[model samples]
Target: MRSVYMDHSATTPVKPEVVEAMLPYFTEIYGNASSVHAFGREARKGVMSARNTIAEYIGASVDELFFTAGGTESDNWAIRGVAHANKQKGNHIITTTIEHHAVLHVCEMLEKEGFEVTYLKTDADGLISLKDLEAAIQPSTILISIMAVNNEIGTIQPIEEIGQIAKKHGVLFHTDAVQALGKIELDVNKQNIDLMSFSAHKLYGPKGIGALYVRKGTRIKNLMDGGAQEKKRRPGTENVPGIIGFGKAVELAAEGFEENNARLIRLRDKMIAGIEATIPYIRLNGHRTKRHPGNVNFCFEFIEGESLLLSLDLVGIAASSGSACTSGSLDPSHVLMAIGLTHEIAHGSLRLSLGEFTTDEDVDYVIEQLKPIVERLRSYSPLYEKATGGTR
Candidate 1:
């Protein structure tokens, strides 16, 4: 069987070019970026070059970008750092009901520490209401955190609008753009985004590397307190190899970003059309046209998502129900629930995210295999039987 990978949201395979760029750093240029010797200067040059490349790609200043372990660390630092630094100004932070666990759990922790949190609700299309956002802002509200694109349903949030709202209310705005980087056009200055988190692996770079963007004059406390690295904002020795890979990936993404998006959008639409034409009683999740170009999510009622995932794996197809971070949990997706899906419907959802490596053949293969898989799973489902009145 030909293997097909449709779980780009979970993680992406490192590209060849990225690997080639990273190889020398791991062996030839092995030196601590924090040292003062010639070897250290060489390594520091690589780090600065990578930082400039990423910063230019995202329209941020080099000093504004700080490297981290990945999206989780970036997000945790953004939320905790901003909230703590501005604690005297306010005690309230606003977010959404469907954010990634990194942001959601951080908000929960802050809540336990006496910070008030307001989780805005999304409509059936997984969109937050601008009116609700404006209404939620309080005199005590100091920060607003939202993801650029949802990991599970792949809904694109109105970051620009949210940013404007935060500005109007004098609150800092942060966005988790791990899923949006490279797939969409993002300029922090144009969007008024004060803070943004990103992961290298999501954009064909190596894992264990990420970055956080902080606009100039933004007040933020350092989560990692140590060396003078990252302008004294984040400490610890930088991952020279991984940062090189990320820079290479960003360079590749910038070369033909629009062209790649057009190709992926066509493939995604083809897969959605094929699956919708063949499958019955399935509800498409996320906004039809407002979602990411490579995202396709669906809820096949009366089946379990894990079962469907395993069945697909057996046939050499890899997909996901939500974020890789939340896999193995028996509970239904919080994102699905936030969009008003019942537990039964949410449990049967599937997410297929494409990437640069995804081919038309891969899309066709998944559609051809999925029809039978859904039928097989639904046949074993008592809920299906009861819903269909034994119609089969």
Candidate 2:
């Protein structure tokens, strides 16, 4: 049996070109970016070039980009840094309930530190209303951190409109664009986004590397202390090879983004349509139209998600579920719950995120495999028996 990967939102395979671009840095130019020596100069050049490429992709200046470990670190830095630096102006921050743990956990930490955090609720479509955002703003609000695209549901938030609201209220706007960087075009200036977070791994680049876009003149305190690396914003020896790979990946993504998006959208829509048409009692999650092209989340009623996941895995199909077990307690995804999914519905949710490498055959394979797995799970479900009038 051939394996099919439908979990790009978790991480994607490193692109071949990106890997090639990083090869030279590891062996030929393995020097500390902080050193003034020739080897260091080569490494520094690679880092700067990568920064420039990333900046161009997001329509930000090279000086605005600061590399970090990944989206989590960047998110932590952006939220905490801004809160610390802007405390004189305000002590309150705003964010939605459906954000990734990176943002949500940071807000929770801030709450423990005497800062006020307002987690706005989203509608059934996993979108935070601009009206609700406007109503949530307080005089002491310092920042609003919303994601550009939801990682689990692929819901695209109204970032630009939120940016406008932030600006109008004299608050800084930050967005975790980790899932949106390559999937959608980003212009920090046009969107009035004061700070943005992106991870390389989400775009087929190497892991352990990401960047935060802090608009020039945005006063954000440093999360890390030490060397003046990343302009004293983030400290540590730079990952030169990873940065190079990231730059190559960004370049390729930008070059092929239009075509790749169209293809992935077609595949995702086909899969969603096929699954709904073939499977009974399935409900789609997220915005039907205003979602990421590669995301498809659905809930199959009357069956536990873990059982369905295991059944799919048996046939060489890799997928994910929102269910939580007792000990591990992964429970239903907060994202689904935020979007108003009942506990039962959330427990049965599955997220199938496609990528540039996903093919029509892959989608078809999943569709074909999913029906039987769901049927098998439903066969043992008491709810299914009741709904279908079958004898228990």
Candidate 3:
């Protein structure tokens, strides 16, 4: 059986080039960035270069970007940092129900602390309305935090428009661009994004290293306290190897940005088309076109997502039911629910994400394996028997 990996959204394999770039930091030139010695200065040079590379790629100044553990920390720091720093400005914030738990949980925690949050609803396609966003903004609203792309369904939010609306209201705009940094075009200035979060692993870099882009003059407080690394904003000895790997990954991602996306889009559409044409009673999730180039999600009727995943795994095809973080839970996806799917449909969802290592043959292999698996799983379902009257 051919092994196919379709879980790029969960995480990506560190590119060989990224690994190569990181190798030097482990053995040679290893020094804590906070140290004042010559070795420290050498290591600090590498860290600064990486910071510059990532910042430049995202159209940000070097001073505005700070390294963190990963996207989750960046999100927490962005939301809480801005919330606390600007509390006197307002106590209200706005986001969506479809956000990753990183953002949702943070917002929920803030609510418990007496902060008001307006969760703007999204349409069935998972796109939030600009009108709802505009209307939800109040004089007491301090921040508008939204994801640039939905992790589960791959819905690309109207960030530029949302940013404009936030600007009009004089509200600070932040985007959890964890799933978006390398996949889409992001310009902090052009998008009017006051803050953005990113993860290197999402872009084929090392895991456990990410960055937060805080536009100059954005009122945000530090979330951590320790050594004076990361401008004392995210103080800790930097992950030198991880940081270097992240920089290389971003550089590589930018090298063939358009071409890579075009290829992934072809693979994505082909998978979607193949599954839709072959599978019965399957509903495609997310915006048909306005989604991540590599994301293809669907809700298959009758069969549970976990069953489908296991069957696919037996065929050496790796996929996901939803966000990797919540995969262990029995509850259906909150994202699918937010998009108006019923409990039955939501429970049957699958997310197959394509990426750099994915190939045409891999996609073809999945299309070939998926139909039989779905059919076999449904054959055991009483609901399927009832719906099809034993015909399936």
Which 10 successive residues of model 1 have the least lDDT summed?
223-232
In angstroms, what RMSD does candidate 2 have relative to the true structure? 1.9
Least accurate 10 contiguous residues by lDDT in model 3: 223-232
lDDT of 1 by residue, 30-89 (tens): 899889998899899999999999999989999999999999999999999999999999
Cα lDDT of model 3 by residue, 1-392, tens digit: 78999999999999999999999899997998768998888889999999999999989999999999999999999999999998988999999999999999999999998899999889999999998899898999999999999999999998999999999989999999999988899999899999999999999998999999999999999988887888889887889999999999999999989999999999999999998889889999999999999999999999899999999999898999999999999999999999899999999999999998899999999999999899999999899999998897
Candidate 3 lDDT:
0.94
> How does model 2 fare in lDDT?
0.90
* Residues forming the 10-long window of minimal summed lDDT in candidate 2: 321-330
- For each candidate in turn, the TM-score is 0.99, 0.97, 0.99
**Taking the candidates one at a time, how many backbone clashes does each contain?**
0, 1, 0
In terms of TM-score, which candidate is strongest? 3
Give the Å error, residue 90, model 3: 0.8
Q: What residue pairs clash in candidate 1, if any at all? A: none
State the displacement of the C-alpha of residue 251, model 3, in Å, after optimal TM-score superposition: 0.4
lDDT tens digits, residue span 4-39, model 2: 998888889999999999999989999998999999
Q: Whose lDDT is higher: candidate 1's or candidate 2's?
A: 1
In order, what is each prediction's RMSD in angstroms?
0.9, 1.9, 0.7
Instruction: Evaluate model 1: give its TM-score.
Output: 0.99
